[model samples]
Target: MKPLNIFYAEPDADRWFKYDRYPRRLIRRIFRGPQRPGGVMMVAINLMKGLDRLNIPYRFNDYRYINKHPEELACIIGKPQVLFNREWKNPVLFGAGVFSHPIDHAKLFEQYPNLVKILVAGEWMRDMFEPYYGDKVQAWPVGIDTLHWAPQAIEKTHDFLIYDKTRWINEGLPQPFIEPLLQTLNKRGLSYRIIRYGSYNSDELKQKLHTSKAAIFLCEHETQGLAYQQMLATNTPVLAWDKGGYWLDPEYYPHRVQYSPVSSTSYWDARCGLKFSGHDDFEATLDTFMQNLHNYTPRDFILDDLTLEKCALKYVDIVKSISE
Candidate 1:
């Protein structure tokens, strides 16, 4: 049998998934009919690339939410043999299923319960959901676009920039640590300029990641660290927190990527790139970050790790194993 046509929907306007490019490439192969939104990135990105690789045809039903037109979305989903979600009309196609960070699982599950095949980012998360949705969990970490992620050597450039839009403060992340991080920058005196944004637009955020030095992600309630991969694609490092491990890639380190342990939440391990739990310790972390900044190159991140072909293979597995 041929592939299935999928209609992927990412209506999270509040926080765009920033996955436009991915869907475009994936809608090409193994598609016989319409496809619906699967879980988060692992499923979404993989399926998107699978279709794209096989040159399978598909649809992008983004209008479902952006335009508030479920009727239009229904039409786009078209008729299929098996729908990905029960809520999805037939001949419906389901990719992996829905996935969210630790904090948002309950709410997300409530909203998209039909979302089957839950995909997780880290190992622990797979365990976390084993009780609630046992045997359905799959570790689908983020992938990087070597071509798009590569620093154009000219796309954009900045020295040691930390950009985050999350209201970590309002979320009780504390400001004591932040002060130290800033102070470390001040003491380093490298003129490290920090960039930040208020709105949560994917395009705007991607632009920031593509052009900045590194991402300062302090979210204590995140699902996956797809954003970190996006930043790595731009040759940027990441200074992330442990509260978000379920979402962040475990490969993250203190050089190309540094993270905090939940226990060490009060403090960050200062390393090649440096990780600090509190901004108050920023002075110390920033001091190390500056001292070793030049040595911590982008190559350390391995931006080319996830290739389209490999991702396509994973998709083939899902499509082949579907409950035909």
Candidate 2:
């Protein structure tokens, strides 16, 4: 019997440490990690996602340094195989861990006879990849690093805790949410601090979230919302727009994650999350959220299964299927 092999072909990137919590023991091969962030996929953050539970004991092989040719990428294989994306070819059996680009999996199979399948993150992303790979692409949201984002025992306040990007004010909605939210909050004579972790320390972000009453994220669109999940884990009430914005923020469609109605006033319960459409009607939604903020003690949830650890296991299973 022979041990199964898998390659962990990390890019030449930096901040790989940010994902240090992600398990790196599942591979039998490696190409050294990258030297900087945003290497391949607009930032290819995926390189280090779900690092919290990375512990599958396996051998790790070294990279074959070539003069200048691009690093040879070995996909979803357990055996040590070497080939260029152009020369050595095999039908792509599946795109289990593949992200969506402007291409489809079938065409991917056609263009590169070696590509047989592709599993994307979600329906939105699938649309991007389906055109290039065809029926080969599917959506399967990846997991996050939970251990670093779990709940803790801490004292909290009963006030409005709005968690958002710093741009909320400088980049307030030209004529909508932001501008109105500012006016709305001011009129009520309420004082709340907006926490933006653009480049802040993790400890600091955690501290603010714990003390605050709720976490609010109102953005355009998101594919997968990592921060939202973390807030949920902490039991902090969440407020955001519907349909999620930009993949950079983990998006939750169909109300999977909780987001307070950006236009509601009944925000006292911090159960799952509240949500509102980013539509013109967001004003009312914001009003509702503001009202809810007036009289609510944030509550937490028992999100044990949704942890990043569990998410990683599911991803590993997809990888294993592709390998098999």
Candidate 3:
């Protein structure tokens, strides 16, 4: 098996605080432990873990080694500036938030002619990028760590765990979406808990999932929603807000670009749970979801396609395709 060269230069060394001197750095390490990884950093982290579990040979962020062996396939997973002053002589798989969009870095292709492939998290993202980059764009999602996110033996306490991650402020306030759901839960006399995105950590979420019978995922759309998938891995079904329409990202919607048929959960099926477009349909859908909760086998879906080893093997295949 050929060794892969992977590079990720994000969540920079000075992300938490400036450790200009040894004393400050020591204090930070002693007090704060380590800074928690953000979304992009987690993608790189999980991919490496998957590779490790598969026992696949790979070099991580070894520029000097890569320079010596220029013939090997190199993957730049994030942060475009990693290639600014460096000269990589091999074909590269570039994306996972390398840029906000292809148009943002219009000259990148000309600058780095060796970037043979563009990586996006899902088919919808690939669709958005396909026009600009053609067949070079590929969809690949990082696998969830199912072992750590498995169902716990604890008793389920709450009927619902509302996950709030809605990001479009101009479309209107979150109250329009959330208030109705809360009312429904209240009227039914169901116990529930609300967890806003970015306000909680993984350990906190895992505990909540263990105690909750189901989840109400409130998100505009997802490239690949790892949190909801984590919920699925725990056998906690989700009632997702999948208001399918034009890609309404304020940065690139209506004015700059227009795309359609986006999703909240990119890799989902009927077995996962239910979906509601908005307030009009949410009530009906929620009732149906509650009635059919016992029929959902979400964990089986995760085990089938999104396991660490399975996704690692898929990644290996992508690397091999580009190399050949």
lDDT for each residue of candidate 2 in 1-324, tens digit (9 for 90 to 100)? 112122334332223675543445323124443332221231123322443235543322323322122222233421112222225333333333343334222334555665545555445656545555566665555443445655677766635456554333233445744556556556776556666545445577677777766666654444444455556666666766553333332333223333322222111234555676554655676567656654532333324445445555565565566556
Best lDDT among the predictions, by candidate number: 3
TM-score of each: 0.57, 0.59, 0.92
Ranking of models by lDDT: 3, 2, 1
Put down candidate 1 lDDT per residue, 123-172, tens digits, no spaces: 55565555665665565443444555566444446555565534434435
| Candidate 2 structure, TM-score to reference | 0.59
Model 2 residue runs over 4 Å out of place are 1-55, 58-100, 103-107, 165-177, 243-271, 279-305
lDDT of 3 by residue, 1-324 (tens): 877888997533454557545576677779977766777787888888899999998889998888878777788888777765467797778866566567776666688899888888899989888888888889998888989989988999999899999878336565566887798889989899999998888899999999999999999888988889999999999999999888888888879877888999899999899999988998899889989999999999999989887888888899888877
Q: Spell out the clash pairs found in candidate 3.
A: none
After superposing all C-alphas onto the true structure, candidate 1 shows an RMSD in angstroms of 11.4
Instruction: Return the top candidate by TM-score.
Output: 3
Cα RMSD of all models vs. native, in order, equals 11.4, 10.2, 2.7
* 1 or 3, greater by lDDT: 3
Error of 3 at 105 (Å): 2.1
